[model samples]
Target chain A: MDTFLQVLIAGVTMGCIYAFVALGFTLTIAAAGVVNFSYSEWVTYGGFFGVTLYSIVGLPLWAALIGTVILCVIMGYVFQWVVFRPLEGRHFLTIVTATIGISVSMGALATLVWGPYPLTLPTFFGNGTVEFGGISFFPHNVLIIVLAIALISVLQFCLTKTDIGLRLQATAQDPDAARLMGIPVRRMRTFAYCLSAGLAGLSGFLVAPLFVVTTTMGFGLMLKGLAATIVGGWGSLKGAVFGGLIIGIVEALGAAYISSEYKDVIAFLIIIVVLLFRPRGLFPERIAEKL
Target chain B: MRILSKSVIAAALAMSFAQVAFADDIKLGMVIGTTGPFAGGEAPLVNGTKMAVEDINAKGGIKGNKIQLIIEDTGSEQTGAINAYNRILDQEPSAIMNTTVSGFVLSQMGTIGDEGIPTLTGAASAQLALDKKGVEPLFRVRTSDLYVAKAAARFAIDNLGGKKIAVLRANSEFGNSWLNQIQSVLTDKSVKPVAVESFEVADRDFTPQILRIKDAGADVVIVSGDPPHFVVAVQQLKQLGLTSKVIFSNAGVLPTTIKLYQGDSANGIYGTVDSVPAIDPARADWAKRYREKFNIDSDYSAAEYYDGVMMVAAAIAKVGTDHEALVKEMRTIKDYAGIGNTYSYADKGDGGRSVAIVQIGDGKLTLAATIK
Candidate 1:
């Protein structure tokens, strides 16, 4: 029973990370109607940016995180203006291919700058763990869970309640009509892209201390985030979170009960099963339909 | 006009002869992954090889003929390795050094056997490489995982007195081979591991695995993984409060790895190493030279490859670059001391039998015991 609880907590912690990455995918796909295959590189670059600020530049952890966010915001805008803006109404495959190219280029650039060795981030929590009710939790894990929930709550509130959120939703649903109604659809799209990039940057910053920061780290998370987005239903924010949690818990349980070798296989099997039953996803884009 | 034409033809003939004479230099081909996942290890190997070539050439060359090294990047893949091998064969190299990855080296066995070029490798520590049927020309400078595992098992049982052991290995060719050898050694000693877990190479979170190991009440944890993964596991182990004596395979003995775990937390962790520069002044000097040259800290891979290059140079000098003569000379080398270890190729082409047990003490690698 204790083992089960510990694994559950571990799974949830990992699920939160997946959810954060998946949310980045969700926001971009909803806004642009194209999947950003290079979204994971944003996470990787963000983590390395933090490494530069914290380890190389000798900034405090909080300052480093802020620097990462600012850098990611600029990166997001540049990617939009330079890469996506030119490809605006082109073939969906063309945009995705460009994103893949971006991903590869970023990985190469990182390797050229930092070399292939993985870098370590100093943990803010100093390797401390908290035990309560016979459950032991690393402070980093607790922080990840709490921060993920808070970020998601803020995102949900903004998307559902704010006027800009309505405009963003309006643009995603029908850019033609949104523009006809005097809404700046392009601006909303850029804003959504920047927001999504910020979320990915935050996830990267949070995960670096737990794992080694390497250029390839984002590629792995990209696959997981794609799996989550697919399983949860495309363009469904709440579904992305659920999909991530489900993937994480199932992987942990599979590793515990079945075999670690087959954990990834089991997670993909769940995706297959979900696709077979719910062709669209567990939660389809109902908001888009309503709009 | 006829005299001018005749002069041009004569000059062209002279240039051709000069080219042939320049090509008479002994050529040694090196296939390494200078770019990709194995780049970290191969970079140092390349530097060490260059240093050996320079040192040999500075001493009036081997047999008064300057050695020419032809380097090709394997890109850490079998296809890339095959392409590199083909390119090297085009140059008609007298000998070849295979890449660091075992799988890539094994993939090139047919070519190595058919060509019969004298080959030496500092990587590819799999025992099967020694026992492979078509590896007659291939020699290993690095000791196999079997020896490292035997040394680790003996230390765990005899030195540390660990009864309930836990084995956590990366799911890789090297890791699996080491795990099997360690298990065999432990089973012979009438002890079985309390828990066994395997993680993928890219896995970051080991919380569930470590928790399970702790639940099994293991007194010792034997880790077989690469440096980055090993560092993460050690940090996670400390975070989870599992104070079991951790023993690492040779893969985790890099100085940079130790730097990641500096201070008290790093103390008492044991690992098997091929060489520690602090134990020998000659090795220390070699390491210092390497650092000054490459601007990076040297590891066992660099030392072994340095010795390999020197051995090849000596062989070329003793016997001309004839394939059969080079092979025979390499086989006859007995206890030829190098920067890393004294290498003696057994009948099966396995050399370097020395393995040392070392502990991380006060942010430094301290020699504990030598296993021969």
Candidate 2:
């Protein structure tokens, strides 16, 4: 029972990270109408930004996170303007290829700037463990779960119960109709892009303390997040959350109960099974439907 | 003006040709990961190689022919490493120096064998020696993983008084070889590991494995892997509140790896190191010079490669650049003092024979015992 509790905590923490990154994917896909694969780079850059502010510049953690998120939001705005605006109506492959190019370029740029060494970030609670009933839990793990739930709740509330959120969803659902109804489609896309980038930045900051920050760290998370997005059904926010949590739990439980060697294969195996059965993901509904 | 420009260009070309013609410099190829996973560790090796080449050249060269070091980036992938090797081979270097990644070396063995160039690497996989019977030109500059595993296993059982043992390793060729060596060492002592687990090199989360180890009630855990895998594993194990005595492979004790550990998690953990400069005061001058030159702490990985380059130079000085002659000379070198160890290439191309066990405490690695 103690072992199960430990595994569950780890699985949930990992699931939250994946869900956070997947949130970035769903937002851009919904509002921008483009699957921005470069969300991973945003995650990487966000971590670097936080590292610089928190570790290098010696700011408090909260201030650093806020600064990092703001910087990432600006980066997203620029990214959309520079990469997406020029080729907005082009073939889907063209934009995706450009985003891919951005991803590769950002990785190289990170290496050039940061010099390829893994940078360490201090944990929010300073590596203190909370134990109960002979089971141990890292304070950061509990913090991740809480923060993720809070962020998701805040996002859900704004999107469903707020005016600006409705406009954004309207723009995403039918841009032509939204424009006819006096909703600035371009502005809505830009807003969602910036918000998504901010979310990516938050994910990076949250993940930095858990894993050493490396230029290549984003790639693995990106792959997992991409998988989570697909498993949850692309463009579905709830799907992203469920998918991320499920993958993380399966991976933890699989490694614990079965073979550690095939743990990754097990998490991915769920994706295959999901795709085979649900096809649209576990939620089987788009963000537009939720709105 | 045109005539003058043409004359200037002609003079430049003539000087370049004259320099090349007059200077028959020996070429050495350095292939390492400058951009990928191993880049952090491999960077120091590059610095060491560069320092060696520069020092040798400044000392009037090898028999009046200055050494020209050609460095290439491997990108820390097998394909990238192979491409780097091919690029270096285009220069037809007299010898090649590779990184500490065993997988890269294993992948490039066929090419290195075909080229028949004397190759030196710090990769610690014991499989290299097992495969060295047919490959004459390959030499391991660092202590083999087998020896480290043996030393770690023995220290864990005898020194730390550990009874129930757990083995957690990276899922790689190096890790697999180290696990086998540890198991073999334990078997000789009639002991069995309580649990054995492996994680991917890129994995950041290790709680699942730690939980399993805790559940097994292992008193000691032997971790076989490189940094940041080693660094993260130790941190996670500590974070997950495991009080087991932990032993790590050589990479665990590195200054780069040590500096990344969260809080005092690394304080009580034991790790294997190829050399302890503190034990040998003779390394002070070299360490000081390295610090002054590279602006970084001198590590055994760097020292091994530095010694490797110097050893290659000594062999070239003895038998010239002939590959077979140099190989023979390298084998004949006895008690060649280096920054890390007194390297004398063994029959199986293992130059360094000893491993030092160190315990991390108070922000430094304190040498506990030297195992031979």
Candidate 3:
């Protein structure tokens, strides 16, 4: 039972991380209708940025995270203008290839800037443990998990209940129709990029507490996020959250109950199995009827 | 086969082209990870080897010839390693220095076994590389995981007196070799493990594993994974308030793990390190030289590969480029003072190999005792 609880907490904590990373994926897909494959690089950028500001430049931890996210935002805008912006109106495949190229470039740039060594961030919550009703979690993990949930809730609320959120959702659903309704499509897409970059930053900040801040850290998270997107249904905000958390929990449980070596592989297999059965997802997006 | 035919033709052409009054610099083949997972170990290794060649020429050219190291980044894959070999072979390098991951080395082991290239590996410590299945002609300048695991196990049993241990190994070849070497040693000593399990190299959480160890009455945990993977395990161990001696293997060389574990939590943790971070003034002087050379804090890699370059240079001096002759010369190396270890290559690929148990006593590794 104790083992079960520990695995649960760990799964949720990491699943939250996978969600934030996948949320970045979901946002870009929603706003631009293109899966920005470079999403993982943003997460990696956040980690490298965290290392520089926190370790090298000696900024406060909180400021470092904020600074890293700011950089992530700037990078997103730059890549949009420099790479994705130029390739617009081309085939979706072209855009995806460009995004992949951008990802590789970002990885190389981060590699050059930080060197290939995995950077270390100071444990944000210290080396403290919190015992809750006979179960325990690392204090830092609790912080990450809470932050992920709160941010996810805030995202859902803003999307379903706010004015800008509606405009953004309109833009995602039908950019041409949204533009006819006075929504600036380009701005909305850029907004999505910025939002995606921020979410990636948050994911990296959360994971940095758990592991070393390596340039390659985001690759695994990105793969898991891809699994999340597929399982949750691409561009469905709520589904991304649900699917990401499910993927994380299942992966953790699989590692515990089955072979840990096949943890990542198992998650992908589950996504494939899910796709074979329910091609859309466990929770498909609702279609509004025009009576 | 086509590439090889082309390579042979190119080598012959290059030899013929050399005498056309255009003396192209002698190309020394170099292979190391330029990208992918094991690039961490490969990058610094290449950097040091390149720096050594530069230093040699800065003082004086090698035998009135400027040595040119022609590098090919083997992308941590067997196909890449073979391509690198073919490309460098076409360039007519006198010898090849390879950068390969564990499984990739075994993949090329046959090539070196049949071809008898005087190959030197910067990394890849799978036991099979040195086992009977390995290419007889292959040799590692870098210490094998066999010696590393042996050193770690010997330290735990002899110094830490750690019995009732928990073994947490990663799923990779390096991790499997670590578990295999340690388990055999423990078995010989009649010490049974509390629980043995495996984790993937990219496993993010280890709490379940830790809790299992806690329940099983494990007093010590021997973790074998990459630095990031092992760091999570150690940090998780600390979070669980499990103060059992968390002795890590060679993977503990990453200083980032110490930082992630917070201040002084890594102090009592033992490892078979490359650098005795605490050493007499002589070793400190070597560290100073290393720091000045690399403009970074030197770790086990800096010490280990610096020594490896010197050993390979000694081999060159003793046998002068004959593959069998150099291998024989390396076999006779004895008590040679190396930056990492002071010894010679044994009959197998392990020469000049010595493993020592070092502990982080005051935020820096100090020699606990030699595992002689």
Q: lDDT of each model, Cα atoms only?
A: 0.81, 0.84, 0.73
Residue-wise C-alpha lDDT for candidate 1, range B229-268, written one tens digit per residue: 7777877787678989999987666776776662366678
Q: What is the TM-score of chain B in candidate 1?
A: 0.91
Whichever of 1 and 3 has more lDDT, that candidate is 1
Which lDDT tens digits does candidate 3 get at residues B107-215?
7776777667667664546554555556655656555666777777767777777777888888878788888888888888898888887876767788767776787
Best of the candidates, DockQ: 2
lDDT, residue B23, model 3: 41
**All candidates: TM-score:** 0.91, 0.92, 0.89
- Which order, best to worst by TM-score? 2, 1, 3
Fraction of native contacts under 8 Å reproduced by each candidate: 0.29, 0.60, 0.50
Query: Could you give candidate 2's per-residue lDDT for residues B243-263 as a string of tens digits?
Result: 999988877887777878887
Candidate 3: CAPRI quality band: acceptable
lDDT of 3 by residue, A174-237 (tens): 7789999999988888888888888787677768867677767888889888878779886788
- Candidate 2 off by > 4 Å: A285-291, B1-24, B130-134
Global local distance difference test of model 2: 0.84
Model 1: residues with Cα > 4 Å off, grouped in runs? A286-291, B1-20, B23-28, B60-71, B87-94, B125-128, B320-328
Task: Give the worst 10-residue stretch by lDDT in candidate 1 chain A.
Answer: A282-291
Point out the higher-scoring one by TM-score: 2 or 3: 2
DockQ of each: 0.48, 0.65, 0.47
